[model samples]
Target chain A: MENLRLLFDAPILTVQLLLDGILIGAIFALAAYGMMLVWGVLNIINVAQGELVMLGGYVAFFLFKAGINPLFGVPVAAALLFVVGWLLYRVVIFRIVDKDLFISILATFGLSILIQQLAKVAFSPDVRTPQAGFGTISMFGGAVTVTWIKIISFAAALTTGGVLVWFLRGTRMGQAIRATAQNARAARVMGIDTDRVYAWTFGVNAAICGASGALVAMTYLVDPYIGLPYTIRSFMIVIVAGLGNISAVLATAIGLGAAENISAFLFGAEYQIAFVYGLLVVILISRRIVLARQRRYLA
Target chain B: MSTATGKMALALASAALLFLYGPTGATAQTEGDTINLGAAVSLTGKYSVNGKNTKDGYDLAIKRLNEMGGVKVGGKSYKLKIVYYDDESTPARGAQLAERLINQDGVKFLLGAYSSGLTKAIAPITEKYKVPHVEGNGAARELFTEGYKYLFGVLSTSDYYLRDAVNMAAEVAKENGRDPKSMKIAMAFENDPFSLDVRAGILEAAKKHGMKVLVDDKLPPEINDMAATLTKVKAVKPDLLLVSGHEKGATLLVRQTSEMKIDVPIVATTHCDSAKIAETMGKQAEGILCASQWDRTLAYKDKWFGSADDYAKTFQKEFNYPAPYQAAESTASVLVFADAFQRAGSLDPAKVRDAIAKTDVMTFYGPIKFDETGKNTKKPMVLYQVQGGDYKVVFPSKWAETKIKYPRKLPTN
Candidate 1:
């Protein structure tokens, strides 16, 4: 009898979970886009990508404290993060651009720890959310309920993605960035300043992270330790979607989000992280095997 | 595998491992004007918030002790001093710092680290070194099951966190002429020791009180989202929503619950009394219930901080925020140390350990009585409702200030 009730209730629950996953997955996609841009252009796996998101969250946090509407925190956080990203590149990324790939990973990992500690000192360790007070709207006679802030965050992510695509396709700097990303030596030979392009790409990446962080601050709770998970999720999304594939990245992230939500439901929340990493491992291994088979056939 | 060469190689590996992580030598004992209490506080990492609060609690206790004519031991009056280092919220770092404090600093007495994980790490060091560690924050039941005589916990074990809340909710249900057996609960918690212990207690209490558990979910370790679980909650519409996911989980649950409008009769959680939840959620915080180990509204008093209300006022005046239960328990840990030191009448570690083992007294925080497991078994957990801006105790009528506002009314604007 109990089983029958649960079985009957499964449909509405599934619909609600699906909506929640896509909305949250949109945020994941936005944060992952930032990761993809930096990775594609710089060829450096930024272990501290999540820290930038954390810093962005802090920007929104302070702005909200200063009595600005938390919604306005989105753009303000972006602009501030742009400056931060530029500074980080000039000081750290510039010097280590030509170092061994392993060296960059280790350095960025250390940078991640440094960022977490700094946020702890600056913001204190209390968990905080800026409470946009957007309220909620029920759907399907309360079978599904959607928070307004989540909707706004999802819409903002789409708009940001749209703007980024337009800028990349139309602007000269975007073309230069693309050229540098494709062939840095050829772009430099063509009189394009590769160094400036790299810095701008990193800065824009940071700005994207900042905007994502503000939305997160409104939608989810922010803590100093929340960074590394975001970094890992973005990395997973990029890997699953492939580098420099923005539209695919967005689609894959939503898919991953829905999958995660469903898994969280079926397997319980304790296994959610393990499930994600497990999925990443499985995907990578299968991709490797497929490539090996393709290489044999080609030979 | 058991050949002579293999044995020799195994011995060499063991030696190398020991050399890498073995205990260092303790400096010569120096009895001076101050008694140094070493602590590996998580001051610079994930546990930094509670760590800072714990440190402030220690600092306040030490300051008050000095002002009131410090600990008198064996015809000598000595001031209390804390020698603390940031553990960075890592178990390994906490253990390493504990070793350094015990060996390099020659500090035999110890204070607890912030979270249960850190405390678990630091406990073994105290046991090996024969140091008396009085920890106020770490309350996981696993900490005491090791049977370490030298370690003591000042706070009640996490098993009692929701015991009172479940019982009171059952009682409140009876008062409203609702069937206790018909009352359903939705439980979600992080898969950590503290929260797991809380989950265990809620399950037991619910079973004992004849309440049906509609949903029991263990939140993911990183805890990024609660939407899926809250969605299930909305589907079931349980009469009570019980959660025990520490600070971050608690705040997220409250915010999302209000946003989703999963209007249960009660929204009781383990950490809602925290300023993080109360201050962040503001008006949405009203009517939420929290299972608190100690509340300022409780009718308790002591010579040091006077009543619970006085402690709140004094703590706010000094620290610029109302002291949470962590701070209160940390302060009580210090007081327990002081009480033991006075009773022991000497600075000897063994004597202090024995004195602490036999402690049966009361303070502003609660009664300080330890069972054989070194846990304060006498302290009863209290239930507090987030009424306006305060965590008002609303259970066990003797300690309660106001009757529990039955059937938590969600604000509809």
Candidate 2:
């Protein structure tokens, strides 16, 4: 009977834990969705994606400091980063995409280091945050506390995601991009300028990444080095979602969040992030095993 | 095969092999030969502030030693040259640098590393190479327990720093008529071995004072969202908060604490040496207490630290930041290495190890003597509180040059 009582009590903590996980998971999805898009179409992993986000954050921060409203700075930062991304793709990434896979990886990693070091040299490693607009809103008899800034930013991300999904599904440029991704040679033969599509796709990814960073800055402080961890977390989410599954991205994020919370509650906060990495290792191992078995069956 | 001539030749060949690969083969340096020391300081990462300061301290010591005509041994003075590599506070990179230092650089003495994880990672390479490692900044107890004969730590552990800070906090709480026993304490530490050792100290001290730890949290090394952690800390309503981490982590925590209006006094370990923390937190960091082995502002009239103030002053004048806690540690390490090499009267690796094992010298930090476990004895920690945005000695009043601020909150003019 005592054990039953304990079990009943566990659900309340579990629900809270899950809720915390899902909230953080939502943030991860927003952060990594751009990477998935860039990877799926361009066939080159954008290692500097996190740095682009950081650039966006700094832009928003400076704009806010210069007397612009933070909410208004998001789109402006996104647009600025879009142009920068477009230029970067034209100058750097596009030149290296056709190179060997290892070379491309090295180029992007080098680009990441260059961007990070540039940021370090230009803007010291001090933490920055866009000025806050609205405060927290209480929900569910005060059991849940949601910040207005978080809600607005997260809602904006969802809308942007929906708009992207719609554009890809319903627009001419989107169709061309999809066609290029599915069969580049076929699309090129049918009069699609595949190189132009790559540029546009890469620019769009950078713009979205910027928006995510700006939104992140509104709710959280960002230091120059936050990009590396963002990259790791984004890769963790994308890999765990089993690749090419958009909806599973959210599910993976939520799973990670819940896992982190449970680990914190049971094992203590020191092991919470460690718990997330452990789950990532498990997921990666399982995927490898599944792939090996499938390859054996095919053989 | 068993012929007498064959057996004699085989025995001779085995003897040659032993001479090349055995313990005696750990790079036999002659009395007149120069001893190479490898330094893998943080140099450029988050701990760069302290790492650079430590490097400066190291360079200054090495320069002074060389100017004194080097270590005199066997009727000759053989100058020491340090082959310094920047590990940038990454443990994996530190390990790689350690391997390079041992295998490629052929260094028999290692003298720099600030982070505990970095030191722990590089310690094994020293053991494998059969060279003595004189740790400068790291303070994890686990490093001492590894049973490696060649590893010697010069600084007090994170455990000492945290316990001293907490004990001081407890003293303040008791004096202010707050029930020290019932006072809620929150432990927020970085998720690393150094912080873990400090956390252990906090728990131990809290138990001693009968204080209840209401909240405990660990932030990742790359965490920037200390807002949530601060919120959790506030919810606990702790009378005291113990923070164990390095410069960046310390700065973020104090800043977030101010934003959340969590007025609970902070008790930090030796991680408070970074100038960035004071600059970032500004007014918010005032009154936060920390325990350390040495603060640059502290001057003992007759001590070696006082004598080294000119060296520390140069660093402060150049960088516009106070000298780091590890500066004295690194400086002491150079002195220890010089002393050992001089005592050994030879630069031979085994002889140097023996000399270091038998080291008994005074340094900037204190009287340095290594136990059988290669842990330094006579190393003591002092408590300091940030008063008027400057860290001032407050505890061990015998050594306290400034008046102690006994209660919480910064003293008003």
Candidate 3:
């Protein structure tokens, strides 16, 4: 009977769950967008994506420790990450840029381990939250509550996504990168420096990860081992949405978040990751079947 | 070619040097002047925080022992030295390190690693070698059921870790004019041995009291954001929200509770001050309660370490951080071994094991008496409530220092 009463209160609960899911999903979308940029242009799936996010979170934590607001630390981390990304490209990534997919995966996976170890040494394996000092606001007559930091992070993610979209559509470097991603041979024949584009594209993805990490530090907390989940989540999001489709990516991110939140509530939290990986397997097989059907008429 | 030759030569020289100095000198111990204690601790990785605390605890104990003229055994005094290895919180690595400590380091006395999983791995190695292992932290009762004669824990077993939390919840429920059977409690525990034991205990206790489990969930293995769990917790609106998410889960619960204002009457968790919740969360963690193995404010004391308060003050002076329960229990483990060593009056492992089997001494971390299963049977559980950035006892009528703000009101600031 009490459970039935909860069913009557479903509207308000749904609103709160959806709001929480969508906001957190925005952060996931930002991370997925970075994955899309690197995968579309460079044809490399960066397994170290989460490590970069973890690193950026450390940057935000340091800034927060220095008495800077975590909200303002976003761009600072992004800028720092851009430098790190560029350095990574010059040092290790550029060599593997034209390598086999498996080799690239191995290298980046190793890189993730190295970065995680370094962070463990530097930060000492503690879950630290960058204090937002922002309180909560009640919505729908106290049926729902939202933290101001989540709102700030959500807006930051949306604005960062919007700015990236605008930059891709409006800038020359972005056009060259898009051209390279669309047809590398043709772009190279057109005298475009595709190497430079690849470097900049990788750097931009890292910057995106750094910004997302800063936001995550405020909304959630940061840990050295917390990187792999972000990487796996971004990979799943990119696959579900299809690479380079910004709008689709955003929608899929929210969908994934909603699925996770709802599953956590319904099946309890233990099975939440199982549902996520299970969803990923289902999406891949179903998408393969759909593509197989699409090719049957031609065959 | 020359560079390769140079590198090979360097490697060969390093290997020879290692062989000469080797990791362990176990066989040399009888001839040597010092008693060696081998420790496989998680000095790095996720469990490092507690592991470090355990290390500091051992360090303080050893230093204090030396100050008191060390341990007298068989007509001679020998100072204690720990031959430590960093397990990085991996169970396989911890077991391997324990073996290495026995084989390479040749240490007879063993200190258990931090988490239950690591301790489980190390326990069998100690049993096989018949090395007397005195573990401080790993509280899961599962570690004892294997019936390793060589293994003993100074801290009480894990099922009892959260037993005090459950009893207090019922007490608080009754005080609030609510029936224990009518009250609902939600819980989320980490999927580790210690936490699983905690969950089992909480469930059994709740059943005894007839409290309905509103939400019982194991946190997802990898994801740190437990806001999803907290969201459900908000909707359920249970009388008490109990979590055994270890340190990370504890921090997340506190952060999310403050963020979402999930305002349950009581919020209890594992790793109260060990995770430094009061310092980290500040206002957010105020009034939160936890199942504590040892609180510094406890009046329990003995000859070596004085009172629990004295141990905390000394630990703070040395480590510059507040001593968590793990630290206190760790010091007690050392005291247990020393007491056994004194009674045996010998450096022989077998005799020392016999003495340890008959241990019935008191220390800063309660009494160190082990049952047949090698668990500390004398130490009692205490329920602690966070107040003004420190833990205050609120359970067990005798030790009730301050009243728990039942329903736990926040400061008006």
Winning candidate number (TM-score): 3
Whole-structure CA lDDT of model 1:
0.85
> lDDT per prediction?
0.85, 0.72, 0.85
- DockQ of candidate 1 is 0.40
Q: Per-residue CA lDDT of candidate 1, range A107-131, in tens?
A: 8899899999989988888888886
After superposition, candidate 1 runs with Cα above 4 Å error: A1-8, A285-299, B1-138, B148-154, B301-306, B310-363, B368-374
* Complex DockQ per candidate: 0.40, 0.15, 0.41
Q: What is the lDDT of residue B245 in candidate 3?
A: 80
DockQ category of candidate 1: acceptable
Sort the predicted structures by lDDT, highest score first.
1, 3, 2
The C-alpha RMSD of each candidate to the native structure, in angstroms, is 8.6, 8.4, 7.8
Of 1 and 2, the candidate ranking higher by lDDT: 1
**Worst ten in a row by lDDT for model 3 chain A:** A1-10
Clashes of 1: 0
Ranking by TM-score: 3, 1, 2
Q: Could you give candidate 2's per-residue lDDT for residues B1-413 as a string of tens digits? A: 66998999999999988765542334433223565678898878888888887788787777777766777877877777788888978999998998887766666788858777788888888899787889878777888887999988887776777776667677767777877787788777887777788888789988999988877777777775554455455445577777776765666655545444555755464556543445444575777766677755544322233443665675577557766667777888888888887788776778988999998876656667898888885565777777777778786555566866544663221
Candidate 3 deviant stretches above 4 angstroms: A1-9, B1-133, B175-178, B312-327, B337-360, B395-397, B410-413
- Higher-scoring candidate on TM-score, 1 or 2: 1
Residue pairs that clash (backbone atoms under 3 angstroms), model 1: none
